[model samples]
Target: MALQDRPNEKPEASPADLVSSLAEASLALARAASEGEAYAALDMAAHRLAALSSGRVSICELGMSPNGRALILWQSSRGGLSIGEDSLFAEWYTRASRMGGEMTPARGHIWYGLLSADTLNDETGIRVAIFLKFDEMKEELAAHAYGLADIAAAVALRIRKQKAAALERRRFDGMYETTRAWLELGADIVWEASPEGILRCRRILNRRGDISRLVDGMDLRSLRIGGGGQSLLDFLEQQGSVRHMRAHLPEDAQGRMSTGETLYVSATARRSPDEDAPYIGTFTAIGRDAPSDGTRETATMLLQMRGARIREEQHRREAEAMLQGLRLLLSQDSSREKMSRLVGLVGECIGSSDACVAEKGLDGKVRILVPQQKSPGPGAAAALDFIAAGAPRGVVGVYDIDAAEGRNIADAFGLEGCQVAALALPLRGDAAFLVCVTRRAEGFAPADLDFADRFALLLRQALLLREEQSHLAQTAKMAALGQMSASIAHELRQPLNTISLAVQNLEFLLESLDFDREAAAKKTKRVLAQVERASDVIDRMRRFGRKSVGEHASLVLRNVIENVEAIMHHVLLRAGVRLEVEISPDVTAYADQLQLEQVIGNLLQNAVDAISGIGAKHERAEGLIKITASPSPDEKGMTVLRVEDSGPGFRPEIAERVLEPFFTTKSAEHGTGLGLAICDAIIRESGGRIEIGNHAAGGFVQIVLPRQPA
Candidate 1:
């Protein structure tokens, strides 16, 4: 029957009955196997409390959500009644509990009491809530409600602890299974030995039946067929570890014992300060082999091969890293910047803070290319001395400052104290480059020296290439200058002749005794203008002949075209070729100005030569050369300058070879064949190219360049 239907008079609970009911609840909870059974036992306890008080009592287990924002009614004594954190009863109970009052309720004659599970603490966020319904609020009934709630809290905490333990046990079981399977698959035999090198436990993982009994309880050291080397126990005692140590079993009296079989053992053990410790290791059986020296040699060779493979892999990775850094260094636009970054990259690769590149000149003086300073550091002097002594060419030398024999070498490199080391690699000739790297630690290994040698060789090749290019460019420039000398002489003679005439007129006017001052002044101004004009021609030629430093900047197309036209005008006039130039003043390109001038002049000269040849062949033919510049139609962000001539286009058979170095159509005295090749190189260096082709009008040579940004 429901408690509300009971007599109005509250029945007082006897102490013996309450104690018996508490004992029954505790007994039920102790025997509970799962959370459901535990909850059921708590429910019975709540009913017993209600029966004792003759009042309706409800027990609810409350837990915080993972986010701790709301209460969860995990379990309850009453059935078919839902209570949420938002409910009026729940809100009132929560507030009353915090306020430390038991009188607050949302319904008639209802009182709330909170029970603590101190063991659960905040980690579990679990507590018990009891609601009691009576005709009036009584202290005795409130006490009973709290007692039931306490029993429920204790049961819940016990269940949670049991669940946690079970989960941990399952996790460990999975780990043990995984580890056992891994060992069985990967190891031939796994073993453990006592401090005295006696076998404690050994597991053979072969597919064949167990043979472990044959060697059970035997001293592991007794299994080896000893020669003259240290025993396995000695290795373990000294190094605390052993790897790939060869051992063999004694030959059986039968024929099988005569055949040689070996075991490869590897082990690691713990060591204490005052005593030896037991060890665990692995052993793999090797096939039959010849006894003694042959077996040992084969094992040694195998180990060496393995070590070589590992070292080779390491070297490949390091080489790749160094190559990547080198590509970045080469991308730099300035020579000085590239040199500075080169030294930095070398230092990083060698794990040193001091590195430099020095050039040994023919005059026997060494100069530092990087750092851009005159003074040398500690190792710099020693490196220079080695270079001066003609250090073995193409070989990297390493010196340990701490060694007696190496002390002199160390002093040369400026290494003063012990432990520091220096590495020097000289280029192939007496007058060549030297690369030095110094570490303030132990000497460099053979592999490091090898890498440094290779890097130095690469630097040498690059320098040699740059020098050859410079020489070829200078040669081509001088050739062009020589070809233009005749035209240039005639060009200067015209102004000089005009100045001479003007001077003679002034002198005659002054000596005639009826000299006109205005006329004389006019003659004098004419002479001055002629002199200035002659000076301008010489200045343009001088600038064009100057060497290029390979710096790029925006260049006005019209200005460069005009400068080239001035140099080539007399040549064209003397050859009877009409030159037409069509270019806008605003059109610009990104390139070295002097190099661009050289390229344009070379093209104009070639056109003049081609048209002159055609004229010589056809006596009545008109020679015409046209130069035009504009933004390229086929490529974005590019400018095209075309030099077209009204001459017979290149011969089909020789067209492809026209730009090749040392490949020329003209006789030896007329052309050196480097003019077009040099022009192509200069254009390519500026991130551009030259295209040779024929249009309907005649042959055209186009200079394509990166256009200047607006």
Candidate 2:
């Protein structure tokens, strides 16, 4: 995938021919004792082909350009004629195919085509050609080639083995040696499985890879993950491996495994292959506060020297360069803030003043459209409008400014200007809309287009994360504030109730000494109840604010809601609000009890506030508040709780902002503005959501809670 190494453009050799050639060559090298032996065998093989061709056949070398054709080099056994090197194989075939006689091999079994002319040097004025043809007996020549290949393979294997032996001798000093030894000791990679049988790895080895005592011949580089004899039995079972599954013989039952679809996983579970335990070296990977901090610091001090510092700086530069390369990878970035920074740079990256994006609409049209650019040329402007008007393939695609002609600019495309070129990039698949890169003067370059396309992808994915992070931060803050406010409210209730009661007692103390002690005691009890009610209100708020989660179970939701109402009845009465409860029978849901309680309390409190804010304006028509709960008909398993107050209805515009944290119509003293937001979060966590708006009764806020299957 390097820029220069574009595999897409690389012409693939015929699979049959490639396999045949590689197999034959591998066999030869494997059989040879050394490189010299392999070369000698190749020369002898080439000589045999020459004798078989009657000295007319040739071959091609790999990666030799003008090297576009099949590469098969030649070795003449006997011929007065010679072929020039400048001729390519494709040209030879083309010419050969056109010729009257077909390509026929001579006396040998080897089958090969002539290397033909590809170029004529302009300066030298020299033309290259291959006039050779396949002789009658080609099979003999093939046999000769195959024989040489076999010898070559032997030579290659011997040399490779010798080198590997030298390196394998040092295995005792390295982890690989440790792994190798363990595998030899009849070990299997150990892993732990969940009760559900999901196996997470504790180690990997023994099940696959080279377990043979002959260390010199093993493939060390491929000894891990897909290779290195890494046998993923389960991974293979789940995700079929095209490599070894079909290639290896005898279908090693010992290597039976499974795989994961999205994440490639090893299938076989670890077992005691023998009585002995698997040997694992006991060396700890130190954490940040390791006891060897002193030595580490001393090492760090040493690292600060010129050699280490220079290396560190070099590494830092490399990382910075990589960041620059990935500057447009807004999607891969984990942070929305980082994504936002990338967003700011997006315009500059695309050479546009303003660049906003739109996502694909559900109707397969373009919506949520964004135009990025302050003032673009007519083309850019038209481009933006065209895409904005028409649907795009996805969140991102090519938007030719030429398409938008003779259209009213500003009125049509939200805002428009001179448009030169524009490109639309869809974010997050085609889920949303396209980002229009409206540029002025210059059109987008190829690199610019490619960059914008990828950037748009990254940007879209990042947006979702950004949105989630933003929501979490807001939720956490609101939860904290809600708890504090609730606690403070609870603490103040008793004192207020005490003061109210003392005033009542004083008012009566001035009366007759026997001023109906029984009635007086009842009045004092009511005052204490109100104080307790205040304490209850505080407790409810604290419940709403608490970070701890309650155990979940299916419960009769009606009871939970009734309990909440009972707890807050005093507070509701003090505000002069009438509470109404309407819950259908047989209503049940799986949810955390305390959390549901908090959810119900928040809704009730919101109703009281809305009523108080509106009802206080006039003494009359202070309406009733209704709370209802029932199973959702459309959703197979869901419960809906609706709390409605009969006060002035909510304005449609504020409805959307109602659930946002720190958004309240009332002054700071009366409300923390965290109530609805916390309610939304708590509900969502319990698998639900809350909505605010005008009710049929007068005003309403609906809370939707998800119910787990009963």
Candidate 3:
């Protein structure tokens, strides 16, 4: 990093050579890396010059004295020279007394010569003093005194330049370093912008660097919103000259504006003699402060308020988005898969890149439901084991997992080593939902955790809904079995009777001496066919009887209707009615398969009973029930399912009541009245609606369900 040392050289002989040597010495001093090296070069030059003149040369600093004629040797080539302070003055007087123009001291006698400058005086006070013996060419040496003066002057100049450069460097470094320190201690931004709002320079002095660019262009609107209190634009426009103006700057998060920080700033429009220049300003940040005075207290309070407002705004937005996502989750059936994606979405809303949901089971096992990513390494097992132990049960909160207490949980989040914050939602009993989000430790403030708490509330609500739906689904399955019991018995009896008769016939054939092979074969085949029919009946009964697993998926209305018709065929036949199903191939919807079938079957059963009850009162009229499904009238994202029966229509006043729970018109033994009500709930919860009315020839029930999205 420093220049290489100058080439070393030997002393010269002639006066001309000595002058050249002095020039070369000056160049070597210039090449010196530091002041110490330069001094060494000067000493070397003195020694070389002493050798050339057959005299010892020394550099001296002239000192202030009473007589003003003293020399102090700073560096010497001759070590033992003792020249008295008055000796030089005595010599000068002797020369004057003799009246000689010039004279060198005699040989073998010690005398001193000074390197005197005619033009440049040494501001540094150093002079080159040469101690020598008298020589014949004394005037010659004195005649060329200017050359020695020039050499001394060159050394002085080099030293002076080096000192000046070092001083300038120190000054520059000190000023900028002090400025930087002050900025870090609470100076937010140093910015300069054009009067027309174009930014010329912008610097952020805080860890929150992303927001710096928000004010780069210095737009009046951004300033007004980002800085809340006084109208920044109006102030800037009205100011003839502004300095250290206190103003409000509001925070902007993805275009959602709210109150931000109060900043002390100097904004000035530079003015020359001829024209006004662009505005230059700085927004000084106010950091954490403990004030000893009222003024300081007020300033600190303002800064705290600024930070609080920004956090409150950000948390509100995140909470709202989180609640919306949870609503969407609960709107459908909540599943582990959907919940996983939802956790990630929630993380993004709250400015976290990593998030997950975990469940603690009764068997001391922790299940990560959402973000079922790769398992953690062995290093994380200890933390995960603690969670599985259910130590945090019922201790619900938004916690900084990176802190002392939360470290274990944070460590278990896997992969990303960012700061973690967790929200735990306790379900019934020992089961709990633990949701975690991760970011830099400072990224989340205490107030920011409020959003996580809101998220926990949403998760709790979703869990409650899921439990309620499960209970409702089980209750619906029970109600369906009670309603269809009699029909199921009647439906299975015929096949059972056929199997018994076929077995008796086969036995009779086998008892014959020469068994009628063809007859026995026919009877065996008949019996096998009957057994198969019985199995089918049992399978359909089991499908409708078991609990519904509330999972939503795409299903074609035509296919679902065919399955329902097959299951309910005997029920319709025993009711003395004909069931006709007409469904378009393209009528599809997103719904639970078993639940949808149950709804349609309930509707049809209600229709069958209504037709039978009506027939008992009216003269024997042919009973016909028609179930139809097609796309909605206007082709919205919906499928309309209609069930119409040739029965006494609903009493006009009771049309709406028929859809209400426990409002069936049928006899108590035959109806629980939950059929239509359950169907209505299913339709509405699927983001659709249900309608009940009297059509041209029957009581009609119409269902509109959300169609599968393209």
Candidate 4:
């Protein structure tokens, strides 16, 4: 090798100089390696290389042996036509082949090969690649190439490490700053209290950040810990331990803790202390102290659920109390003693002053059995009392005691102040009765009302039963009166008729005597006819008012019209009226025979009265009374008795009230008011109907009775 071919060697270069130059280059490369740069950094390399190789650029790359690639090989390239294998690619390849290693056949001088983005040595941040050469001498390539590659990898690794270090510092600082702010705001504070049922307190912070005394005491997300507070020592109860005493405490949205006292902190989560993966934290804090924000959120959710359960429990208690009252009212019995006990029990249930019961009395006045309230009407003197009475008026009613002036009725009744709300129930018997209650301020809820209503219903049914019983007793009285009147009328009829015959005989015997005798005989005959008419009326009343035969029985009504006709005949004749009867002998009913005759007779009598009224007072007709009986067309073989009269006809109200007992427009002496009542009872007992209305011809009273079984 000619030294002159080395081209542009340093003018004063020497071996000593070369050592110094190499040393400089080595230092620069080392510096560049630390800074992480490659390839183009060789420009700096070349400047240093000039000290050794002068103007000639010498390069090296990895090489291969004759057998093929080897783990360690070297190659070099000479610039400016200074090599036997002159092409930069080929010459470098050959030089590498000559090294103590093997190389690939590409034979390139350029030191380039496939390189991976992944650092081949993660710890070193070094990326690995096959070392090929371009324009480099074969012999020394591996040595120089590796040195360059290693230096470059070192620089990249250093840069990556520096960046990571800066980021870690920032994150650590962030955690600390945020936690400090939270603590300053008193949003969170670590709590340390002993488990001795004692209240000793302290703020805690460990190596890993954790804070407590917050809205969510042990919650992770809500924990405002300094940078890294969670540590194992926290698990040993070095700070504080949970008290065994259990209690409910309000918690925030995180379910951790709230400002409310008396809350227990039991569960927890923490952050991992590993700095490399800073996102992780250690979770040493249990109840009052927890680190992670996520844990706080979860705790809050649980607290909300607990709160809902508590509310449900409270409602259940209220509902249960109300149901108990209702059950008590429904189970009691119905006598006054039983009733009194019931009212008292209910009053206690509702916390009331008094429960009073009153029944409307027989004389059309209200009476008080319980408490004995005095006097029937409003003029009565009493305190704290209520009244109930039967009237000619309408159905049931309710009145407020407070509105009644000055008498202190409310005070006496325990219903005066705010402590008094009262309810009165009308009894549902023959006549109405009342049950009044004056309650305390809590008043009565619907539950109370419902209970009272049920009790009232019971009393109502009982009262109605008693009334029915009394009505039954009255039936016998009615029957007795009817029988007495009928017998009197029957007895009176024969005597009166006998008297009339005697009077007629006397009139015949006295006709030629003085005018005074004729007048006396005529007047006597008139009196006899009046007596007969009165007797007939008595017969109808007696029969109509007779008591019911409770047992079902048969009756014969073929004689009803005949008997009724006899009663009416004298009246019709006196009134100058014509009476006719058209009825089947076979006509009968499942009725008391006397009752049937009364009904028939009453109809005939009513017709007679109407007809007599027409020509005399409201005057128009020479009246006719027609009685007819036949099988009713629509019934299953039933019978109908009809009495038609020529008269001014019937009034609406009169016809309406005709069947009501003790109701009549006639004078007291003239009627017991039982005529139509008795008639109705007779026909109704036979499962039949009695109707009075104006006929197309004039006035009418028709009775339709069911036929008796053959």
Candidate 5:
């Protein structure tokens, strides 16, 4: 090829030389390791091409300055074209306002072409300009110059890719180091294990001391849970993965177990996707050696706080479960039966075998209420007496039975030949009740003692509630009787009038001159019947007014309804309210007969009051009270008794509060409001519920009770 500056000069050597030089240059460019090395390779290639064509070559880096002017960053020294503080290239750049494409020759035999434009900058323009000085210009020389430019462009792209990859590699290395440091700070040991539970590698991060020396190749099956149970391998196989699992290592050569040193460890492991792949996990010591640095110390503190929170939550759940069991037992059992079972429940909670409730009489004699036929041993009896008489009420006391004072109690209780511990909690009352529990092993923990105290407190509350309910029931019954006073007198007057009339008729018969014996006999029979009728009314009132002794039995629903109706019949009549009963004769309910009657009567009275209240506001209002009993539709094996009244229904806002004590919408002089509250208490004690709402007809009160004893 001929040079553009020297057109008369023959092509350097031949086309064969051009191919050899281009191949060598391409290989050098491929071997370049960095952007600087790549540009050096290009510069060498430009020099070789210039030599082959008998011309001088200059490679200069051009870019737009911050002020929007083209400037030269660097240039080769072999070419005649000079780019300095004041150069021909700068003058040409100023005229053209650009730095790309071929530029016209400024002097003889000098040509310029863009080798690579904007190769480094997309936002700002940059270019590599090749300046060639040849003897003459020719089409062949121009082809060589453009070919070399294309090769340089390819090399520039390679350099850009290399720079990007190096930057990414540096970022990744920094991140990896940071993550490794954090892991080391957070854990005492990081480990990897085989699929078969063999430790492959373990890295200890603790700087102060190392408690675990179990090295690689150890079997996980050899390690047990800290408190003693299944092996670590067994746990891993069952659970597949574990987070913060605490385990104890085997005894070291020094004959020290994890527990003896008070060492606890938390482990977290994850299973790999492939079953045969290794597992990766960490082990952190809990409540042992302190960390060596502030960052690790903070991390350890966070872990301990989290563990404490989890343990607290677990304890709360256990307490709730125990309370629920206590509620169920109290609701279903009688007083005597409940006391016995309650002792048993306390014993189970405290892990004790012998437990009982002792009650002190006014004479200061302590007697066992639970385990009826069993009496406390002499020493135990003495302790119970002391507790009941002088021990602080509602406080749980623990004693080491192995001690001098407790040994006698233990021996007296027939708990010899073993360590024994006792816990006593006194319930509040004049006749104090003491709960006693004895364990044959170690002493009770603080948690166990706390649970026992809570149990005793709940038992006391239940007893108090029962006593209050009984008093309220009696009070409400007397109130009902008071309300029926006027009606009862009126009821008795009619029968008395009939008997008097019959006597008068008999006397008239006897005084007559023609006395008829049959008429006299008939009048005497009428008097006798009236007397019996009045007696029946008084007997019904006596039964209704009496206190209930919470004895549950399956009573015929119809019979119970009849008893209530008889008691409330005159009251309903006085209120001008109609009473309607709709109960199947075969339907039976398990509840205290007197209490059931009280509940029914109270509901009847409320209905009458509601209807009468409406009557006072509107004249001649038809008062209708209906009582219906049937099997409950929503609850299986339960009986439902509904009492509905034709009156204004309960207001939406106050409906839920109606059953609360002393919450009444009636005038204070008329309603003490214990009526519904007592009824609710009685029904609940019978393991039943009462619902009060407005039905389609009007206001309704429904009682649901078990058909059989629970």
Candidate 6:
């Protein structure tokens, strides 16, 4: 209380004057009307204390939050003390009352002390902090910092009062003016309710409407807003409160102009601890004219989704119809009637009328195809001939009757007043087919033309198929003839060679002039046997040539193998390749005997050739060709025949493709590539599978056939 005791004090300041100034500042803070005035009063008191201490000091008034944390609300400093920059000073201010004082060495040694202990625990209370350089200030100023608690309490009280007043002001402004403004903007109502569906208040905000007649303090269910299973009040109870609840209001007994329009509402509620504190909430409503951004976005997305679904359904229908039409067209037999029906179906599917087909006659003229016998008129015939003669390759040419080149056809067909589109397609076997559609409002689209081209392709493929079948039949006849010729030559050459050998023996005996009678008889007998063998070979050849196609029966597979060996044994022996046969007598197959014989003969010949070639290349003494027929492994009612040779196998890359038609590893002269191809066709047609692969030692060809049921 005396200036002489403070070493850091100004020499002129008296203790009594300082005390008087402090009292004035405290009185002003207690009577302060606003936060700014209260802060000014506290700052004045802090400055008075600083003057008495004769040392630079900074004062910070901190507020306790509801959570009991302190925040700086006001700061006053003297002589550039820079207290706020120090984080240590901030920590001291927050817990200053409890900490009492602290010392910081950062930047410089500074002393920090709490000013108010009485208001430290109050949420709205003020706590003050004092900062000074410890080395520059005397220790007596520490006492002044500790004695400022009463002044801080007065400042805290004034601030709490001002905060209450400001809160009340905001509430008052929001309640009346905010609701009224929304009403002017066409809001239907603003309301308040309890948690138990009891309506506490309702204000019709719209001025020109009679909605004010809506009774307040009525149950919310009286409005009868149909939503989900739960009432609006129950929904609010579960959700705390929901915003933008869309609901429709029904007609009520009170004659208050109910428009029954959908209203968008927002609401909020709070629960309290006290028994008297019931749930309270307010809700504001707007009419249908205005929608939130979320609602608009959702509607737009739904519209786009609906449009995409429609397009997807349309494409699916079109694809299904196209598939059905193709199936119908393919089911018809390959004849002129099939083509006619196909054109009619196409005309129906493509939305055309008066469709027709034209074919090129053998007389070098294009004739229109119809159900009845009718040729094109002279003019149209001439036009068709001109177009067919000059038709470009690979293009389905389009013609419109109105064009100069199409006028002759237009006049001949009497299409002057009618619109006509014509497509001319070139077919196989020097044929031209014409299709026409009449009475169309527009020209054919690219989709229509593409469809027409594909339909024409279908006909072309059918024609090509017929031609291929005929050619294959002819080729098969020639192949049979060639095989018969080879067998005959192979069989007769051995006997002929034997006969010549017998003649040479006879000549040697005669030249030596010591011929034995037994030796001549044996030579003469061998020659007659050779001649009989030649005749038998000729007779077999004749029988094979006359064999009927499709003549099939259950035959012993073992017997077929024996016959093939008999026919090929001489050739195989001549090639120096030993033939080995392993077949069970019970193995039998249902197949054409002649075809089966040819297949077996071809396989035997191929094996012989392969072994002979390998023998020629490297005189392999192990030239073994094995033919085996037995029941197929793991397959019921089936028989497997394999022809394996001790010759070089096919290259690894060519193994799988060796069974393909015309795929052969032999030289061109030794094989026409059709031998195995024809054999494969025959075996497959007889209900069998042919597999060819190489074993470790040599190549093997296996054929599995369904066995004949006894």
Instruction: Report the candidate with higher TM-score, 5 versus 6.
Output: 5
Per-candidate TM-scores read: 0.45, 0.29, 0.47, 0.29, 0.44, 0.33
Least accurate 10 contiguous residues by lDDT in model 6: 1-10
Expressed as tens digits, the lDDT of each residue in 1-710 for candidate 1 is 11222223333568677658756976896688788998887777666666665556666777554333336566454322234455445445434433223334543333434555433332344677765564566676666555656666776777887886687567655755544543433345667777787765456554312335434465656665336556667767677877667655444412232234455667777675443437777665555653223133334434665576567656755665466445533431233434555556555566555555555554555555555433344564445665445446666555555555356644443434433333343344435444444554565656766666666655554455445665678778878888899988998999999999999898899998887999999999999999999999999888878876555678999998888888888888998989888999988899888889888888888887777773224232788888889998746788999999877777666666777898887777778788898887777656566777787766899887877521
Tens digits of per-residue lDDT for model 4, 1-710: 21113343344767576556545555565565323343334434444444443334433222223332222222222232122322333333323222212232222222333222222222331342333323444334345445544554455556657765677567656755655443332232333222221221243333222223333233233332233534222432243322222223224433543333222233222233432211212123333454334233334534654565456544443344334323322321212223444455555544456645544433444454343232333432233233323212222233344455322434443333333333344433323433344444444555455544444554454445334433543463464344345445555677677677767766666775555765676767677777766665776555455543222345555575666565555556666778777767766666556556555655655566666562224475577877777777745656777788887776764655666778766555445666676666545534555666787768787776656632
- In the order shown, the candidates' Cα RMSDs to the true structure are 29.9, 36.7, 40.1, 47.7, 36.9, 39.6
Judged by TM-score, which candidate is best? 3
Give the higher-TM-score candidate: 4 or 6: 6
Which residue ranges in model 3 land beyond 4 Å of their true spot?
1-391, 394-447, 614-620
Candidate 2, residues 601-645: lDDT per residue as tens digits? 766666676666632343336658888888876445667777888
For all candidates, what are the clash counts? 5, 92, 9, 74, 9, 0
lDDT of 4 at 50: 40
**lDDT of every predicted structure (CA atoms):** 0.63, 0.46, 0.58, 0.45, 0.64, 0.58
Best candidate, lDDT: 5
* Model 5 regions more than 4 Å off: 1-345, 352-457, 509-516, 614-620
Per-residue error for 106 in candidate 2, Å, reads 78
Cα lDDT for residue 434, model 2? 34
Sort every candidate by lDDT, greatest first. 5, 1, 3, 6, 2, 4
Query: Which should have the higher TM-score, number 1 or number 3?
Result: 3
List, residue by residue over 1-710, the lDDT tens digit for candidate 6. Answer: 10011233343658788777767876786687777776777677666766666555556665544443455666764323445433444334423332223322221234545466542423333556565544454444555555554556555665676676677567655644654444333345556665465665445433423443453565655543336635566666667766555543444633343443344555555666442424443333334565422232334434665576566544544454455344433431223333555566556545566655655545656555432234466676576666566555445555666776656655654444234445555554546555555556575655666665655655555445434533453465456457446556877898999999999999887788676889989999999999999997776656444433434468898888777666666667677788888888888887778778777777777777766663224345587988888886645777888999887766666654555567766676566667776666566545565667777767788887767621
The pairs that clash in candidate 3 are 186-285, 187-285, 188-285, 226-249, 226-250, 227-248, 227-249, 227-250, 244-266
